[model samples]
Target: MKKNILSALLVMAFGFANAQGTGSRFGIKAGVNFPNTSSDFHENENLIGYQVGIFSEIKTDERFGIQPELIYSTHKVENKFIKEGIAYNNDVKLSYLNLPILAKYFVTQGLSVQAGPQIGFLMKAEENGINITDHVKTIDLGLSFGLGYNFLQDCSVDLRYNLGLSNPIDFHVGDENYKIKNSLFSLVLGYKL
Candidate 1:
């Protein structure tokens, strides 16, 4: 099953590679992320993260395009809570290989709006200095909304927000069950070659 999926992805990549000669651009991108987790049981610590990736933008017309990206990303959320007048902090750090396929609609020559579905494969998970990979789901589903601006000299910038659609936790804190969902905002700079 994995081999079949890999084969299909290779075919799609080859097709896109062929199309790149005609107005498509490929580039490298890196950025900072503000990662968050939503849970009523804890106070937000708001961890900062990082992402680096490759992207391909295929133009369909002067004002429309499709952009696909593969990114290595890190997400961390820390919570400090007071129970029985004692304060404790718990932090969860996660790593993922994220794929986002975006549809771009240009409002002007250099500016476009983008929206996409993002699939994330969990690479690692840790909570409070302990490995917690076995407790979290390996696949994360998300939606991304963002804006992009292309400049001269094959440079561009993107600002995006990713909202998680799945609850990633499989355990509880004391007696509290968590429905933790991911939220991230990112700003990336890209240069095409």
Candidate 2:
């Protein structure tokens, strides 16, 4: 199944790379992520991170297009709690390689709306100098919805919200299990080349 999915993605990429007109573009984007972890056990405290990526846009027409991105993003959470008579303050940091395939519809010459599904591959997870990758899931599924506006010289600004659809943790610390899901807001600047 994984091989089939990879093969389909490659075929789509090839088709986009050979798109019919001069409307295809390659771009770079970078931004911050405001991570909000919703959980049943732990309360999320101070969290901050950033994301950077590259994308390719293939226009199927004047009003519609497909934009695919390869992004490196961070998810951090300040988990403060007490369990088993021990107080713990855990600063969890996670990294992921996110693939977002967006369908874009232009509303005007400079504005568009985008919605997509994203697949995130977990790269690393750590908490307070301890490796916690074994307690975290390796893949994450999410949906991204956003708006974009183009500026002069092929530059654009995009604001998106990524809503995670799955629980990622499998283990508990000190007796408390968290049903945590990843939610993040993104504001990225892109320049086409």
Best by TM-score: 1
Total clashing residue pairs per candidate? 0, 0
lDDT of each residue in 153-178, candidate 2, tens digit only: 68999999999998886556755566
For model 1, the stretches where C-alpha displacement exceeds 4 angstroms are: 1-12, 83-87
Q: Which numbered prediction scores highest in lDDT against the true structure?
A: 1
Q: Against the correct fold, how does model 1 do in TM-score?
A: 0.89
Kindly give the stretch of ten consecutive residues in candidate 2 with the minimal lDDT sum: 1-10
Clash pairs, candidate 2, are: none
Candidate 2: lDDT over CA atoms?
0.83
Candidate 2's TM-score = 0.88
User: Which 10-residue window in model 1 sums to the lowest lDDT?
Assistant: 1-10
Error of 1 at 45 (Å): 0.5
| Candidate 2: regions farther than 4 A off | 1-16, 20-22, 173-176
